[model samples]
Target: MILQALVDYYQRLLERRTEGLAPFGYSPEKISYEILLSADGGVVQVNDIRDNTGKKPQPRLMNVPQPEKRTVGIKSNFLWDKTSYVLGISATSKRADKEHAAFKSLHQEHLAGTQDAGLKALLAFLEAWTPARFAAPHFSEDMLDANLVFRLDGERTYLHERPAAQALRAQLLASQAEGQPPLAICLVTGEPLPAARLHPAIKGVSGAQSSGASIVSFNQESFASYGKSQGDNAPVSERAAFAYTAVLNHLLRRGEHNRQRLQIGDTSIVFWAEAADAQEAERAELLLADLLDDRPTDEQEAARIRSELEKVQKGRPLADIDPRLQEDTRMYVLGLAPNAARIAIRFWEVGTLGLFARRLAEHAADFHLDPRPWKTAPSAYRVVLATAPQYKDSASMDDAASQLVGELVRAVLTGRPYPRSLLANALMRMRSDGHVSGLRVAICKGILARERRLGINSDKEEIPVSLDKASTHPGYRLGRLFAVLEAVQRLALGKQINATIRDRYYGAASATPALVFPVLLRNAQNHLARLRKDKPAAAAGLEMDIREIVGGLADNFPRSLRIEDQGRFAIGYYHQQQSRFRQEDGADSGNTESTEDHIEETQA
Candidate 1:
């Protein structure tokens, strides 16, 4: 199914002939220099073509002839190759002499009888030129290993772009079917054609080999079934292989300001939309990219994104926002991860564009909280990173965090119960760090609220976005009590203490409340007394607040809490803490630094 869809998309690109897209048997390769040659094969000047607009000189991507799928063997590409093949000099290659010989011989055989000036000159140059000429004043040491192409000295076009060279390329492609694999039924196209012995390389995965990696490969005898070897086991045709790989590369490649790509943890994702109408498909893609990728800086584009997001958040169809998107337009999202020399399928989902937009809408609603933790609606990318250790890179997350990232993303896309591991990771991080920021608490509340709405392994009451001054659940009330105790400590003493009670006892107070709360309560009495002598009004208000929260609970604290209760505890603490700060912030409305979100941690 994946391959068929990819092949169909490739056909769409072919028919459209999208600008800058490479055609069949051709690919966009990075070429650094152009070796200008005279009509008699004498070296003229080596021209640098690398772009210098950025901080460093980057090679320019040019559409050249399809390169060979080289392994450890010595194979040369047509019309273009690196200095090791073109000039027999490289910074690291030890067999430059043999590679240069192979390049010269290959070009000689292909261009022997050509009558065109460009082709004849190129053949003459390859036949007489030696690598020793690289030491000339016109050549520099930095160009020793960079890829180079050929061009006539006085012309404004490359030699490979000449009519004779194009004809030769077409002829070579037509004659490539000799000594092919046996004909078999192609799995991707359902055609009786020659099954490719090897598939093309797929690049752009985060940790894969820079050269490329394979999606379908059978390198070991043990991996084959019933004596079938390599591509014979899968039976994908060469045409199908090229089509699918081409589509993948096109989607994976990044332009100057591309947003179609997103990475979460170790997984690299590419998404697209298709519809009966090509413009509608492009519109859907732009909307999806705006929703999941980086925000645009242009004022008009930003306003459009905001309008679309507002519609989704209100439980309205995304189609209603912009030109009324078609309900039947399809959306495809595929994620790739690296596995040695092969690529692993982390996730793939296909659905209607409207359906995906609605899924994103639900995600926005699920993450909602009182006192928003972020200026923009949080994406699945941020949610996954919240589970990783603070200051650590997402691409190198631990095994559990990496596994949870994919599952949580699937949950958001499919409206599943949000893998129980999500809540577990949130709570675990809170306990380990002794820091319950508003963001983590919002995540906890989101998990508990969404799971209850779905009726999954939960019989708990609805967790509210703000503080509940009248709840009887022990976990909720205890969380409130813990926040109150910490507040008392902060108020009696200023905010300059070395470590507050939260830094000392949050984990134990949440898990084994029976053992920890009694001591906290005793300490709170001393603080209340000290406050009563100095600030009578504030002390009385705090005492009543403590009495009211404790009155909701029964006589004693529970010995321990279940997983759900732990999440509720975090939510309750966040709510009470934020509610307290909001009151203080209101008193000093003119001061922007009155809020306590920054003092907690970066999680906010």
Candidate 2:
């Protein structure tokens, strides 16, 4: 299904020239250097094609013919290859004579008897080529690794771009037609076509080899069954294999202003749609990418996102926003991760374009929380990072983080319940870090709310978006009490203390409150006494708040809390803390007004 969808999308891209998709029998490959040659085989120059603006070389893409299969033995391509083609340098360990003999023979077979000037010049250059003379002054050690393209008589156009090169390529393929793979029923196309012995390597996946990695491969004899070998087990046709691989490589290509791929943890995610209208597909892809981006480039894009989200929320038909998008256009999102020499499929989803947009909007609504100073709707990456241990690098997250991210994205797309581990991990971080961030709180609330709506935990009270003073959950009231105690300490110390009660006892209070709250209340009384001396009214107000929270609890603090209750505890604490900040700001403003009135009376 994945391969067929890719092939369909590839056909759509091919029909539109504006997409810059490579045509059949060719692909966009990065060529780092060009090898210049004269008609008489003299070395003219070696030009570096890499951009110098960045630390690493930025090679531009060239529409070269598909590269031939290279192995340990010496094999020559028709017009373009590495240093072996232009500088007569062989990459194999065979005897120097044998290597040069093979290179000369392959070039003579392809370029001989051709009337084109470029082909004749190229043949002449190869006939006179020798390793010793070629390596004297023009060839350098670094040039050996760079990809080389030939030029005849210092012409501005590359040899591969000349008219004769295409003819030679067609001739070469036609002669080798008898050597093609055996016919088999293609699983992707459901037709009898030549089966690919080996699928092309896939690149742009994070953590994969720089050269590339394979999605389907079988190397060991034990793994093969019923005499099938390599890609024969899957039975994908060569054309279908090329189509799928080409579309994926185009999606993964970098250096573009707006990329179609995103790296989340160890996974490389790519999204596309099979729409009749190419512009509609492009616009939908861009919208999805912008919505999932953690840090959007600017506020204007954010505002645009909000506007589109509102349209989705109102049940607006997709065609109403853009007439090009029909209701049934298929969309695909694939997530891949590196696994040794192969690629692992993390998640795959296929649905209609309208359903995808609606589900994505639902995901945004799920993450919505009270207005946060940091961000309105946190991205999937930020939500995953919230579960990491404090002061630790996110790159060091264990396998659990990778699993959580994959499952989270799947849930958003399919409208399924988030992984149970998500709630557990978020609470674990909050306990260990002694703090709950805005992102973490939002995740907890989203998970718990969904669990309630699904009837998974129907008996428990629904967790609100903010602090609910009227609720009577023991864990929640305890969290509120803890917040009040911390506020008292902050007010008494003028917010300058090195550490407060939260830093020392948050984990203990949330997990084993029965053992910690008795001692905390005693400390809070002393803090209140100090505040009463300087600011009696402020102390009284804090005392009443603490009493109201404790009064709601019917019994002593529970010895321990369940995982669901722990989430409520974190949300309760976060809400209470934010409320305290609001109250403090109001108090400061009232004090300023009172002082202004006193100054006016003194002046009168």
Candidate 3:
């Protein structure tokens, strides 16, 4: 019986897309499952499903659809994982409370027994059942079973029959305002319908009827009517409502059938499609509603979908096109704004920038390789567009800045910034300087390390390794502390620069050279300026290397400063070089003056 159950379970899993296995369904012939007992007497089960099946099912993710070529902007495959739920419904206060506790305990038992599918299904059911905070209105049993009626007309649906549906629709329409799209009626039955539940009678309804109206029966496990079975109506568990409504939603949304108007008593569901005919439209509504109700909406499923999307191409550019040059075409095709903030950050486990750069470069290229060449925007423009579809070009940095914009300038830039809101969320997890500020520096630092692998160390290379809490801080800019290490770098490279006068006056200079900071003080100042700009451009579009800007700032030096403390000289040899240059220049001027004075005296 256990083997038979496992086999039956495996087959069912293949037929339907479930939590663990891929969509293409595992081949039963090849799948192998084994249970091993742990030292603690707990069982451990592993499935060589993917290996045996040759190719796992490849079901497209939910919530998001694939991007089309003509669409403009960046599309993110961002998703949250689905959460499991355990809904407990019952009559009587004590029974309901007991049922809820039982469900929780049942879930824990499923986890213990290693019945993964049942456990996951229970959790998903529970998640859907859990309303954040709903105040249940006290109702008599008669009120709960009373049938309500409604009608669907154009965009507006009316409950001409059932006072319950009627009352709900009237309240909805009023709250929605007159000019807004008519709200569709969703009949939340006061009680689960009974087994062999016949359609509610509408003896007086006539004008609000749909053509070719047919009674569609569901077993109540359908997402739209999932919890209905707990009531007296649905009995035979073998014929679950999943058989009908699930298929209906799957077929309609997947574009299988072409039916429109779906009439449920006085309530009518009108189609909301651009080209869908009546019959098809009704089916679509039913399917969409089913999806919304059945699918998990919390962070987990979203995370899962997002992870899968990242694995796939949520949005890709035309392969032949360069991302930097294809901004306009990409936006036009993708419907994204050029300056809208859409950033893709990748982290490397080894803490190297080169790995990130290499991977990003690869994925960015792969994104452009759309199979439908003629259907998309130009390859160049589509490659580097933002992830927002409604992004406008008027707020573009190129148009605003016109001449000068750099990395920091662009980072702060926005214009209905596409997906930046999402990016900001991701950025929260990023570490500022390896301590988990977020992904920004983590990604940048990784890129730097990747570049190092390629033997490319540009002149100015200061990836803030850590925040100096005790040192004289250089103030925060663009949410990060900008260290004035550019001064240290230039001083070492035969250039002279001083720390900000504030640092000098306070005598807060560290007693050692800042070995990690690779830029000069002047360059650091330039970075600060760039970050302060209102309309910054993308980092990829910056005309000059960020290091050079910092390097320039490192050149500034005060000519009147001289110090000789051999034993405890906190300043490096670079300080001595700057002093030497000032002395040399002073001596040359003095000599020239002396010669002129002698000549004048002689003439006298």
Candidate 4:
């Protein structure tokens, strides 16, 4: 189904060139060098077809025919290849001789037999060009690694662009019609065509091989069944193979202004829509990029997303919000991760644009909490990073982190319960870091809320948007009490104290409250006494807040908390901490102070 959808979209892209879709082609390759040759086979000049100003070469995509199967022997591209094949330029490598021989044989069998004047001219140039002469002064040894294309005279006519080159390509394709292996019904199109022996390589996945990797491959004899080998075992036709690969490569191609692809953890995610209207598809593409991007560049973009999300939540028609978009447009989001020599489909989602938008709004709603002075709602990326251990590099996340990201995306798209491990990881990070970040607290709340929606733990109390004075969950009250104690210490010792109560007891307090809260409460009395001498009114306010939280808990703490309740503990702490700030200022101040300073000011 994925391959067929891609092939259909490929045909659509080909048809809607100027009206809506960008012009693209199958079997096209981006080359970095264009070798301009004269009719008499003289090297006019070796042109660098890449932009040299950047650290990497910026190549141009050219419409050239490609081979269907991976070739172990030298098989020349339609009109472009390495210098060894196009100009017989041999490097010190042993494969250069074989490449030169293969190029000579191919030209003699194909181009030499053709009557096209341009191809004949190109042949004549190839015959006269030699490795030693071409490399002596004009070309370097490193130049042999770059792709080279032939140009006839000053007309700038590439061999592949000539009429005869097209004919030669058709002939080559037709030759496979007679001597090919037994035909099978193509699974993609339900047509009787030669099954592709090897599928094309899929590139642009993070950590995949530079030469690209295969999504469907069978190398071991044990893996083959019914005497089928490689791609034949799956039976995707050549046309379908080309279509899917070309479409994927086009989507994956990264340019300075490209926004269709995003790297999430270890997954490379690409999104596209199949719509009858070309303009609708383009708009859907833009919307998907905006929805998936966790950290958009500017405030204006964030506001735009928020506005769109509001419309989605309000049940506005997609066409009403953006006339270019259609609610019924079929959209696909594929997440690919590198797995050795093959690519793994980490996640695949198919749905209408409206459904996707609504689910995205639900995803945003999960992260919504009482106002945090420090930030707006967190992006998915921020929430995921909050689960990582302190000071750990999130880019090189472990298998667990990768799985969490993949599952999180799946939950957002499908409206499923979030993975249980997400809550566990967030709680772990909270314990490790000794503080709950706004993003972390948001993630915990989101996970538990979804868990309730999915009926995973329907009986559990919901974590509130902010401090709840009437709640009686022991873990929640303990967390609130712990926050009060930290505030009292901050007020008593001044803001310059090296470490607060959180720095010492957050992990134990959240997990085993009975083991730590007694000691904490005892220490809080000394802090309260000191605060009474210095700031009696502040001390009284802090005492009342602590009493209200404990009063709901019946003045008792739980011996231990389950993982879910531990999440509640973190949320309770975060809400109480935020509440203190709100009570003092009566408004959400967008403060940028460190966590310690912020906690200390909550006392003030």
Q: Write the per-residue lDDT of candidate 3 for residues 259-324, one digit (tens) a residue.
A: 222222112222222112333323333332321111225667545533422332333332222222
TM-score, cand. 2 vs. native:
0.88
Candidate 1 runs further than 4 Å off: 153-156, 294-307, 391-400, 587-604
lDDT of 1 by residue, 380-415 (tens): 656755665553222225533775666767777787
Model 1 sits at a Cα RMSD from the real structure of 2.9
Q: What is the lDDT of residue 270 in candidate 1?
A: 85
TM-score for each prediction?
0.93, 0.88, 0.18, 0.92
Arrange candidates by lDDT, descending: 1, 4, 2, 3
What is the model-wide C-alpha lDDT for candidate 3? 0.25
- Of 1 and 4, the candidate ahead on TM-score is 1
**C-alpha lDDT of residue 346 in model 1:** 79
How many clashing residue pairs are found in candidate 4? 0
Instruction: Assess candidate 2 and give its lDDT.
Output: 0.74
Give the residue spans of candidate 3 off by over 4 A: 1-229, 232-244, 248-274, 277-428, 432-604
Estimate every model's Cα lDDT from 0 to 1: 0.79, 0.74, 0.25, 0.74
| Ranking 1 against 3 by TM-score, winner | 1
Give Cα distance to truth, residue 194, candidate 1, Å: 1.8
How do all the candidates rank in terms of TM-score, highest first?
1, 4, 2, 3
